[model samples]
Target: MDLDRALSISAAGMAAQSTRLRVVAENLANRDSTGQTPGADPYRRRTVTFTNNMDRALGAPTLRASRIGTEPGAFPERYEPQHPAADERGYVKTPNVNSLMEVMDMREAQRSYGANLSVIETTRGMLMRTIEALRG
Candidate 1:
């Protein structure tokens, strides 16, 4: 039924968004993570890419978490000679992650996930009503 297909699509979307949220959370958690050794690179921000692929069983395009890759940017440097991760020049490399950007991405993912949840709920309700009508 069309309602079944709707549920499938929404479920896929929710799954994708959940993955995105997880990535965002990881970035936020490691925003301050630095390298253990001096002159080593710090933790880089991770990015999630979403793609739509054909679901042979469902015969529909579904959202998928295509890749979780590192963000390409220069890591910010802070002058902290006492830090273990400090370079020879007495500057420590900070993670490339921006807390504000991560938070914004998190908010967007949460909203997308919520919308998918709502669709699933509505589809289930419609299915239940249809079955009830059939019994009557």
Candidate 2:
């Protein structure tokens, strides 16, 4: 692939990973969030989904976020009777976000972002060397 095309592909990948990281951060930040009113649902964990699309301009497949969906897992119930959000059964709905899972997802996103950055850097270096060789 051409240098510009390579850079475009890497940029697309970085953008996708950035979006994933943002969702994961939000989930972690709201892990303890509870509803303000009684019998209300707490924050549901958000998930990032990606899809591959053909980039006609670059003549390559690029990754894009298809949608930000909610996690299907059930929310946890905490026994906080005094809490205003508690239901009649004295249980409050807790966010589905799990600290460990969020941390792992964040790490994965970081690594993917880093990989895309490295690809861009390498492609730039190669292009510079090729131009220098042509000058000589």
Candidate 3:
């Protein structure tokens, strides 16, 4: 593939990974969030889904964020009778976000983004070298 196409592909990958990282960060940030009112649901963990779309201009498939949806998992129940949001059963609904899982997902997304950035940098260097060689 040409250097321009390579850069474009990597850029798309970086964008997708950036979005993933953002979602992961949001999940981590809201991990401890609880409902304000009694018997109300707490913050739900968000998830990102990616898709490969054909870029007509580049004539290549690029990764895109297909959807940002809530996790379909049940929230954990914490027995905190003193809490303001406790239900009649003296249970508070905790967010489904697990800090460990969010941390791992964030790390994975960061590595993927770094890899894509490296690809762009390498392609740029190669293109510059080609130009220099032609001038020489």
Compose the digit string of candidate 1's lDDT tens values, residues 43-112.
8999999999999889899999999999997889999999999988999999999999999999999999
Which segments of candidate 1 are over 4 A away from where they belong?
none
* Least accurate 10 contiguous residues by lDDT in model 2: 71-80
Q: Name the top TM-score candidate.
A: 1
| Model 1 TM-score, all chains together | 0.97
**Clash-forming residue pairs, model 2:** none
lDDT of 3 by residue, 25-105 (tens): 898888999999888899999999999999998998999889999998778999999999999999999999989999999
Instruction: Estimate the lDDT of model 2.
Output: 0.94
lDDT of model 1 at residue 104? 97
Alpha carbon deviation, residue 74, candidate 2 (Å): 2.3
TM-score of every model versus the real structure: 0.97, 0.96, 0.97
RMSD of each: 0.7, 1.1, 1.0
Give me the runs in candidate 2 sitting further than 4 Å from their true place: none
RMSD of 2: 1.1
Ranked candidates, highest TM-score first: 1, 3, 2
Residue 118 of candidate 2: its Cα lDDT? 98
